[model samples]
Each structure stands twice: as structure tokens, then as C-alpha cells.
Target: MSKDTSRVRLTAGRVEAFTCPAGKAQAFLWDTEAPSLLLRATPTGRKTYAFESRLNGATVRISIGTASDWSLDTARKRAAELKQLIDRGEDPRELEKAKASHKAAAKAAATAHALTVGDLWPDYLETGKPKRRDAWKPRYLEDLKRMSAPGGEPKKRGKGTTRPGPIYPLLALALVDISEDALKEWHDNEARASKHQAARALMMFRGFLRWCATKPKYRGLVDNEAGRAPAILENLPSMKRRTDALEAAQVAGWWAGVEQLNNRTASVYLRALLLTGARREEMAGLKWADVDFQWRKLTIADKVEATRTIPLTPYMAQLLATLPRVNEWVFASTKTLSMAVYNAKRRERDATQAGRTAPAGEVSTVSESGRMSDPRSQHAKALLSAGIEGLTIHGLRRSFSLLGEAAGAPAGAIAQVMGHKPSATAEGYRPRSVDALRPFLTQIEAHVLALAGVQFDAQVEPGKLRVISAQ
Candidate 1:
């Protein structure tokens, strides 16, 4: 009922005895020691410590804390600090906002700093580069992605029967946790069922670690030496590099059998691989745009150089020209199969925008697969028909090199045609132009045709069907 007129030294006892005015919306007790600091209570008896000051000619008031949480001295100190800030023409609210922002930023940084390798893998696949090659080859990129895939189905042996990814378990581990011991454990487990695949996976993972070390975001977070640890390294099974090549005597049988294949496109695709010595994926992923019939050259995806142009020999041109143009793919297949193509770039672009999808209709290069399928069984069937045995699909590529050599083409010429960097001195001897390589490719094709006991008049224009004249 009566207005209090004096300032008081605030205390626990004073604070406990303070009462709210029944008639007023709020009441205040100004501290005598700190005049600007006050204890305010609502009519319902809710109390808090607060500070008041004039800022930019306007009275600005700020709530400090409740009487229970903050002592009298603490409130006084806060009031003084606010007073000084106001005197310096600084807004206390801006300072508070800045402090809050800094705290939030620190929390966000902590969250990001501990990002797992799995967390960064997707973006890295989209943008990260490895030391082995400039951009990731489609096959290698697919392997990296599938390695960490959260597996689509359950396994039969483990928790259940499904094909889980090899690297899926490691996804939960932080990038910093990929130590030598962790890698050893992973290697031991993987080796139990598939030693060779595990060895390959470990090698791939090492490259990933090296890539992580180069990134500022992941620097010092990965111990790349983990993959090279002696415990894991010693367990790696020694694998012999396969050197299967098509024998000159077998080319005849191989050619006859490949010609009899039900899938003509696949048949030609196989022979093309052998004829050009091109990598399997490169030949399978061939686009119509990459084929320059006018220039008699085929531009193919090269592992060593990203891409390279090989002389499209007369026989090879005829084979390609005879095939139907299903889409952008030169060896287009109508049959549906799972595609392991689309690299990080395609996948990333797809995630951002919906359209511009892969080879489908006009945009699509091949069918579900952008490249040719492995023709192992079909090739085997052809081989059996031709009375040949024990020839693997990849042997066709080796055949091209061997046959090229037998035909007197230099090692450099074969390596260049095969999309290899040419480890031999023969391949390293001056770059062979498409024109220079043409003769050797043509000669190899002729010799293979002769072995098959079939002859073609390459003088005829490519893609022109030869009809027998009626007598």
C-alpha cells in the first residue's frame, strides 16, 4: 500500500523478506551498493535479479537471473559490466548474440570434426580423387561405393542369409578410429571366407586412407598405415598375375565360335575386345559418338588416360557397322541387366536434379548396363562349338596383344591399342598415331580371319551386306 523510498543492501534475508505490492503489476528493490541492479517481483511473488541502464537515450533493462540462482554480488558485477558496455555505445544484446553464436558454432564444429569415414565417403565418391588415377574409373568407383554399401539383403552365414557389403561394418567407426588394430581385425575376418577379395579390398581401403589424409577436412583423422600393418599384410595371399592369351592356332576356332553366338552384338563385342585389345569395360561402354567411321577411329574409355582413340580397322568397322543401333551404345543390347556403370559424377548430378538420367531411350547409352555384359558362358559355348577349350573371356584381350606381336606389330602398338601405358620399351618408343596403328590392327584381323578359314573382302564398304549374284 505504501511505496518504499529507500535503497537497500540486498541479502539472503532481505531477499526472503521481500514482498510484492498487491496493487502494482510489479515491484522493485534497488540495491544501494549497485544502484542500477534491482530485484523485481510480480504480484504473484515471482522474483528475479535484473539490471537497468540508459542506452542511446533509451532506458534498456536486462534480466540477469533469479534471486535463487544468482547471489547479490554476481548480479552487481553483471550490472557493472552492462553499464560499461552501454557507456561505450555498445548494445549488450549484440554482445549476447555474438557469444551465443560462437557457442553454437563450436558445437557444430565438434559434430563435424568427428565425422566418420562413412559420413565422408559419399561426398568423396562424388568429388574425392585417389592417387592411383586422376578420376575414378567407373568400375573402381563402383567398387568403392559397393564396399561401404549398407547391404541390401541379409546374409546366410552371419546374422542371417544375405549378401552384406564387405566394408559395411566399418561404416559405424569414426574416421579417426581406423587404426592398425582395426584394419587387422577386418582383414582377419575377411580372409576367413575370401582371401583374394579381402586382399583387394584392403588395397582399395589403403587408397581411401591416403585420399583422406590429403583432405583438410579429414587430415590427421585417418591412420593410413593401418592398412599396411604387418599383421594384415602378411595374411595377404600371393596371387599370380594371369597371362592367358589367345594362341594363333586358336584364333580360327575362336572366330568361328564367336560368329555363331546367338547374341550377335555380344559376339561382336567379344571379338572387338580381342581385336582392339581394349579393356572389357571400355569396349562395352562404347558410345556411337565415340566411333568416328569417317576417320576410322574408335574413342574408348581408357583406364590410364581417361580415354584414347584406336584405329577402327576395316574388319572391326564392318563388325560394328553391322550391329543395330539400339541407343548411344555401339554394342547395344536389348536385354535387361544390372548396370555397374554410373560413376560419382552421374550419381551426384542425379541426387541434385531429377532428370538427365542415364542411357535410356535417347539419353541412355546401353540398356540397364551402360557397357557390355561378360560373355563367359556364351563365349564358352562358342569355344566348344569351335573345338576350343579353357579360354577365359579376358583371354580375348591378351589374344589381341599376342596376335599383334606375332603379326610383327610392336609392343608399343599393342599396348596403345589396349589402353595400357605400355610398360615395355616397345610401347614407350614414340607415340604411335592412329594411322600408324591401322596397318597392324588390319594385319592382325586378316591373320585371325585366315585362321578361322573365313575370308572377307575388306575392299567392300563397311556396313554393306554382300549378296550372292544369281547365275
Candidate 2:
């Protein structure tokens, strides 16, 4: 019953009676029956069975089990085995440690075999970074999530409620089920509703499979090329690149209609798209610092490269000059304007009246992810207003290139302005100075404006700037 007792022989009754010393963190009592056996107690009086002995002239101790779990006889038997190890000059503690580790590894290997694609997906999304950029683009990341999204709530587009993510069917599947036959069936089933979307989703799923093959835990599970099965590839839709662009005669009217857009930022944004020939996102991320009226240049975020610079023409400058500096963007919409579009305020009000707190960190409806939402509806309206139609946003880029070509601007010059790969040798020879590139950009702007009949001299913008979805 005491730490130094001549070893009262260990019995169920004596074991139950042992208690930890009041001031010490742990207390132990050695059993006379098995000198190597110990009864250890924590300050809280909980006790466990353990064995202590010496090997290679050093004391080695190994825990057995709690008194509640191990009978005295069982503990004595374990002590005898440990004493044999000690007699052989082997550390029992080391052997105990190795045994525990081996058991753990065996359990882990079994669990790893059972891990599924769904199990690894969350980690993949968290650690995944795009090749072209530092992080995944919001919409693209969303597409990754969406293609594999679970089904529950009624969706915005469909009739009989929501469809499960295109990847959902494979989510619950075990890694062993990821075979060419499996992927082929999933593709064909998905292609029935929309071939293009299914094809795109398949591409993403394939990427996931490849990533899994690279991971040690999943390396054996995926075939890697399971997604590239000829059946799945052959089943995908034949996609043709879209060739939409603005016609020359539609410029003036399109420009006027976009100018008339009520939301000032959207107006400038639409006009900027046509004027700069920058991609939609490139224009959306335009920063005030990147725009320099003194030098007459606009450095835009470019997907191909990191960033690209193009001349800021007179009309484009005028359009920007009139815009409100809300945040960092040269063009930003008011929260009121954003809420009005998404009816976020109404939804928030409705949510408030229902005694529900807003969903935490819910995205603002105004900027569809820090940039203007799809301009299709409003753009279509503008086209209608101008008595024109069929001009996609990118069509403006095409329009700029074609218009520049017709106006005698060199292809390389226009290509450089549009942030193309610059295939023409003339592009390499084009002057690097902003002053050198100025005339080509100016002429292109002049031609587009003349066609659009939007003539204006550059005006001094107020020294203030605003922050918008320059995300």
C-alpha cells in the first residue's frame, strides 16, 4: 500500500487499496510476488500495471494495462516475459515501443486501403494551386466544386429540382472502382443532358485522378489513365471554338448603348472591354495605380503572362475619368447598385424578418465574385437598345483586332496591344517604349471611336481612387 513497502504481495484487494501520494505527480508500489511488477498511480488515484527492470545496466520500464483491465496474474505473466528480455540485455521498453509502432502501421495500412476519392477530395481542394496562377481562380475553383457538388436544394436552372454534381456519382465510389469502364459509363450518362459540360467535367475529374496517383496514400488506387480511357474520350462532344465578334457597323450603336448603361461602373466596364480589348477579367481587375493618364498607359492583369500594358486612349480615358473611385478598381459599382441587381438587400431583409442570422460570410450578390456578374443580360439589353445583337464581350477583342487591321495598324502592333502571344516578327521589332507603342494604340482607338462616333479628348480624372472587385 506504500511506495517503499517490503512489497506487500500484490492481490486484487491490495491493488485496489493503493493511492497516489498527495503532493507527488505519480506514486508507485512494487509487488513482492513479482519484483519487476509495479502498481502506478496518478495524482488523481487512477492506477495502472507496469513492469520495471534493468537491461545493459539501465532501468527500463514498460506500461502494461490498468488494474481495472489486467488481473494480477496477467500482469505477473507479462513481467516474467519482460524479465527474460532484461536478462538477455535487451531493453524491454524498446521492444514494447517497436511492437506498438508495428501495430499502428498495420492499422494505418488497412485504413489507407479503405480511403476513397471523397475522403481525399477536401484535402485536394485545400492544397491545390493552379499552374498558371498562384491560387485557383474563384469561378474555376467554383467549377471544380460545382462539378462534384452534392444534390439537395432546388437549383436555379432545372425543373425537377437539382441534379447531383457531374462528379458526384464517382465521389462515393471506392478507388478500385475507378476504371476505364466506370469512367466511360459516367461520361456517357452525363453527356446525355449536355455534351460540352460533361466533357469539361470529365477533364477536371481526370486531373483529380492524376493528382491522386501522385500521392502515396492514393498512388495505388488510381489507374491514372483511367480517365483517358478511349471509351470516355471518344464519347465526349466535338467542341468548336466560338468565333463571335462585333461587326463594324454595330460599333457606334453598341458604344452608345453601353455608354447609356445606368450603372456607371458597368458602363465604363463594358466600354473598357471594347476599348482596351482586354479580357473581361483583365479589365475587371484594373487598378487605379496601373492606370496612368500622365504616361497614357493601362497595365492590366493578364492570364497568359502576369500583367500586360496597353495605351490608354483618349475616349477610354474620358470614360474612366467620369467613373467613381470606390475602391482600387478604375471601375467599381456601388453596393446599392450591387444589392439591387442581386436583390441581396431584399433577401437579407427577408432573412432578418424570419429571425435568421445571415449565412456567415455570405458572398455579396453585387459583384459576382469581386467582378461584375455576367453582363449577358444587361449586354443583350444594350445590344437591343443599339438595334444590334450577337456581339459577345470577347467579340469586342476581335473587333479591335479586325478594326485595327482595316485601319492599317500592323498585325503585330494590334496583337501586342491585345496581349496575344506575339507570333508575328514585327511584334518583336515593335518599339518597347510607351511612346513608341502610343501611335499604334492611338490609331486603333481612333478608328474604333470613329466607327462608334465616340470622339472625346482625354480629361483630367480627379485625384481620388476607389476599391472594387480588383480581386
What TM-score does each of the candidates earn? Answer: 0.60, 0.55
**Model 2: residues with Cα > 4 Å off, grouped in runs:** 1-115, 118-172, 184-197, 210-225, 228-238, 260-264, 287-289, 326-328, 334-371, 421-431, 457-471
lDDT of 2 by residue, 164-229 (tens): 888888888878788899888888988888888889988888888877877877887778988888
Poorly placed runs, candidate 1 (over 4 Å): 1-114, 122-128, 132-139, 151-164, 179-181, 184-197, 212-223, 229-238, 287-295, 304-307, 324-329, 332-372, 385-390, 422-433, 451-453, 463-471
- Candidate 2: give the clashing pairs: 252-452, 325-466, 326-466, 326-467, 327-466, 327-467, 328-466, 328-467
lDDT of 1 by residue, 289-384 (tens): 999989999899887667898888887888888875646677665352223233334665785687655433222233443445566777878888
Best by TM-score: 1
lDDT of 2 at 334: 52
After best superposition, candidate 2 residue 66: deviation in angstroms? Answer: 25
